[model samples]
Target: MTGGVPEGPGDDRWGSDGGWDDGSLDATARVVDADSSEEERRIEAALRPRRLTDFPGQQRVRDQLGLVLEAARRRQAPPDHVLLSGPPGLGKTTLAMIIAAELEQPIRITSGPAIQHAGDLAAVLSSMSEGEVLFLDEIHRMSRPAEEMLYLAMEDFRVDVIVGKGPGATAIPLELPPFTVVGATTRSGLLPAPLRDRFGFTGHLDFYSTEDLVKILTRNATLLEIEADPAGVEQIASRSRGTPRIANRLLRRVRDWAQVHGRHVVDLPAAEAALDLFDVDARGLDRLDRAVLEALCQRFGGGPVGLSTLAVAVGEEPDTVETVAEPFLVREGFMVRTPRGRAASPLAWQHLGLTPPQGSPGAGAGSQDTLPLSGDVGRFSG
Candidate 1:
């Protein structure tokens, strides 16, 4: 554990170790972050599954990836460029490393944000040895020029290095070693068709089921040498927001609680206490998430409020509201986005212990009698 960041089999490219920071109040146990301490990162890296077969969830992606890697192994060549698309914390980066491990190749890690210029990408690509795996995280956010350069590199294993000033610039073709490029992104739609099309396989990761999360937390407990009961593990898994990273994080917090309380084993009470201390509810809604839901239902009267309005009301960046809070909320059926704005669902009203006001956005067809849908008015379906 070098400076809290473990050097592991796939440390080459800074693939996503769930890529979240343990900063702010959310650090108590928030899983939807992009910054974290080196120690925490190392711990996460250490916990990652090095082999695809060892991976916990996303069975479809796991099996498909297995075939792709196996085929390449038989051919003794690098596998096709792979694109991993999913929300944060679903193990895109871990899968990238597993690809390199299965292929028995060195991997060079980098992110779209890191490669601001074409030169940045060219440098990394050109330095790669034969059959190296280039794991690029957040590949959708790469700069246009860098992305253009990557197109050629991914397709032909070559890059155009421009030398000299603008008018005198000479395009020298740089042939890179035949390498496999594995790209991970939270937003695949943002990628241009040309870039997306270059990928030979695209794997979309979805949320882990409670059973899968339980398996992940149980494995983590054994690895961390923490004594935890099945009830404790299940309780933690249920409130982990359907994320393995969150489940592991909650397990660590529960371990701390157990140690402090003089309990050798983590029990359901300890799990509940730890989660309560961290301000995560039974449904995995954090303070920030609750704040958004409350603001929408209570302040905006079930909302049709714009994202900026909602963000300002909740004291968070619009991006955070959109990216971090909204996706989960939307996925969990607590909120809906319409052409006009975001609105709370009836479930959101119920979760907050309030009845949906008659004629309100969430009040349903019964309220439609009083508040008919207007052609010009935005409607939220599903």
Candidate 2:
């Protein structure tokens, strides 16, 4: 919707209406990217739950956050600066919108990458009205100067505006109306301690349960006016990688497949067919996901290879692989990122129908079938 959005549906973002994209093939994005494309964002808006009560997952976060809002309302003031920390696509931005809606105030949207300087941040903070909500996505990525400026703005609701050159510069004191800053970040640990301390409430979102994802898919199916069988809906939900954004995004693609094939309703076969067309395997691992595993197990000899080396083996940039594919792989136990480098778990070997060599990391652990579907191999590093 702004400068970074693709003019059409074919930019860095993928899997929107009007075009069929094999999401994992893109250089810098995936179908399930946390940084989704504009068209996908448009579709997502229609599917988002407008209120906290209606939000489908993260029930604990919802309950705790509800109390914060209610208490703020009673005091007739904006709630404390709230920080929502989690992986992308876990509804941080959606929750930010819901907060403003519940408070009945206007909300301003921006990202950490967009604010380059202290002056830029000062301008945004200065333009606020009382009780308004400023939703900052990827708040951890803000520039050092902007981040320092944010510390004061969050605590004191004021900013020091500098005028003139280095030595001649003057700090102009400016008071701001009391407003709420709702910041979302995937990497909260990167935030400076002083800045992190300013947030009154910090909520960490986790993956949705299979039941939650199913409920989400079913609700959106009716909203999108798609007649889908329970089997089709369940199939899609199972392979959704436990993320709501992915569940809804896949629904559209399956719907498109149904329409083209002259099927009046989506069934299990239809779901499978659509996913196959998109190169999504039964476990929701796309081509890129499998590529990373293959490179680790086959090419790198179950490496301990560097991320850069693995990315090169797969013909992708390191960041693209790290951001777009590695998280899910690490989360789902297909790979591991040790200090040595990236390595395949035993599950990764079995998934590729190969045996882990003797003494390989996790090689003695047994077959991939013996592994849990969502094991914690280790945290994926940025």
Candidate 3:
């Protein structure tokens, strides 16, 4: 699959009208710095798979989505509204763009936060042309009223436009053009039942495998004109937390390091040196991740600690710590979330090169001598 659109090297042209410059595409594409250069954004846009065949991983979703788009094309009708739910950076937005491209329809991108009121959503819905793709990202965050409006729009293709004050309000039924709504959310369970039911198709994206990520990274390296070895690509893929965005980001960082060190290619040593310079370990844990583990173990004695307290210990936001850090830590068995609070696991202690204290929940020791809270620190060699 050609990553949805066809473009060659130095082809920085980003679709008709430069879709990214309008500020709609940046919300999902900018994974690194908020102040990312325009060139960086262009490179990311160029990397996107324009068609379904080109998308990597998610075989089930790819096949199902292809069938949906193909059937819709055969009928000459708009495809059903698609709901894509998963953790961030797993290619929900990319799939949305591919849906539009496959249907040869234009896409209007926006987020739930952008639509504060029912009227806000109504305006966007009213303006869309027939068969357009309306991509509403973070749909769970939308206001209830707007969500209710969306329900009516999705089911009946009509919205009751209120024109005046409460008692004197005039209700006008407005007919909308046939359009496909592709909604993406990290927290699918948070969506109201009626809203969730409106979607005809739902796809849940999972983490990419190392082989899949290697394919993605290799494609990206070629697109970026970076000379990267297979080993270097594998090393980055293994440490990418199964995320394509992170793999691409690591590749860029490795490229930058190699350029700075007068190296012409991204070899194993270049990749390792660059990753070490950036503070990412072999197991893909970054500085913040290590800090959270360290705090939960040493500072809290491996006891159940509150998420907010842990975030405070690291001087980060509770949401950031929970959403960005806790998921992977919990998934990798480094931490556990109980009804009481968050707690470090035995693996966390082992990874940090420290022995778990006796009688602690994660220590797995029964009536043994208490180990020192400060054990010998060792460099992570994952």
Candidate 4:
């Protein structure tokens, strides 16, 4: 949903306002460099699948993405702007990198928060080589001015530079190299309608199925040289919140357990023991996840509690609670959202081995109180 009216003074033309002449570009560059440290760069490079055939799951997205890149190659032109939306760690960043790799183009990585000023976005856009992929992660968090700048840049391959302050400011249109913008967001809903429409193709990644996750785990285990049985991989995959990142993380933990315990390989029993010790259930619920449900059922009386209240109880930011903890809780039928707030579902109580209060907003609740909570945000558990 669109946020309320803009606050403060400035012409909200999509990037014509020279408001970003501030040092936002330098700050963004620094942050991007920090994120691309030696270790992070190594891990991302090692794990990033080089081709669509190597990328796992999201068949529809793969097909569409393949066609877009192929068509762009055939025409010898930059590909259409692409939008990748899904839960965090569901491979949006990976797909963006893959798009660049597939097109044999360089990629410049940045984020919405990094481009606090329109000037920051302009600096990056202008610096990109022709046919490069500008991977903008967390695109939803970009400032208004920067987003506006991005619109003009994407549409016309140009940006207007304001030469002076105040009424005497002159607009200088600077042509940029033809490039592809690959926008990735965990909160696609927060994007402005105009910004969202600028993309030629949008790829929505869904939670991988248990089978898909198992395949991913098996592949990663081989890559990491960790010995794991088929059943062991299946067990880990089933408990990975249908996320490849979670599966990878769990595999690492299980490997540590196996090594310490002197097991030659990860077996089903060993996997179970390792997960139990880590407090991750077969359904992927961890300690904090269960704690959230328990607190709602026991302390808040099956809650229609506000998000802030839940965050306070859990000692997390409201964004973290809403984005990381709530998605899977809702998807597993453990939570429900009402006009009042968030309430515990019957499944939540059942998972916690507690019964809901009589007449609580459970199974037979009326249609009006049931707001469809998004399952994408809660996958990571912060």
Q: Highest TM-score: which candidate?
A: 3
In model 3, which residue pairs have backbone atoms overlapping below 3 Å? 1-53, 1-54, 3-49, 3-50, 4-49, 4-50, 4-51, 5-50
Best-matching candidate per lDDT? 3
Model 1 pairs whose backbones collide: 4-38, 4-39, 12-109, 13-109, 19-34, 20-33, 20-34, 20-35, 21-35, 21-36
> What value of lDDT does candidate 1 attain over all alpha carbons?
0.81
lDDT of 1 by residue, 214-325 (tens): 9998888898899989999999999988888788888988999999999979999999998999989989999999999999999989987889999999999998998899
- lDDT for each residue of candidate 3 in 1-382, tens digit (9 for 90 to 100): 1222213233342334433322233223433346888887788788999889999999999999999999999999999999999998899988998998899877778788878899888867776678888899899999999999999999989899999998999999999878999999999999999999989999999999999999999998998999999999999999999999899989999999999999989999999999999999999999999999999889998757787788899999998998899899988978777655777777888899888777776677422223222232121111
Error of 1 at 74 (Å): 0.6
Please provide, for model 4 over 270-316, each residue's C-alpha lDDT reduced to its tens digit, 9 standing for 90 to 100.
Answer: 89999999999977999878878877888888877778888888888
Worst 10 residues of 3 by lDDT: 373-382
Candidate 3: C-alpha RMSD after superposition: 7.3
Tell me the TM-score of each prediction against the true structure: 0.87, 0.85, 0.88, 0.84
Over 4 Å off, model 1:
1-35, 364-382
Sort all candidates by lDDT, best to worst. Answer: 3, 1, 2, 4
* C-alpha local distance difference test of each model: 0.81, 0.81, 0.83, 0.78
Q: Which stretches of candidate 3 lie over 4 Å from their true place?
A: 1-33, 365-382
**lDDT value for candidate 2?**
0.81
What is the per-residue lDDT of model 2 for residues 113-143, given as tens digits with 9 covering 90 to 100? 8788887787677666789888788889999
Q: How do all the candidates rank in terms of TM-score, highest first? A: 3, 1, 2, 4
Error of 1 at 186 (Å): 0.3
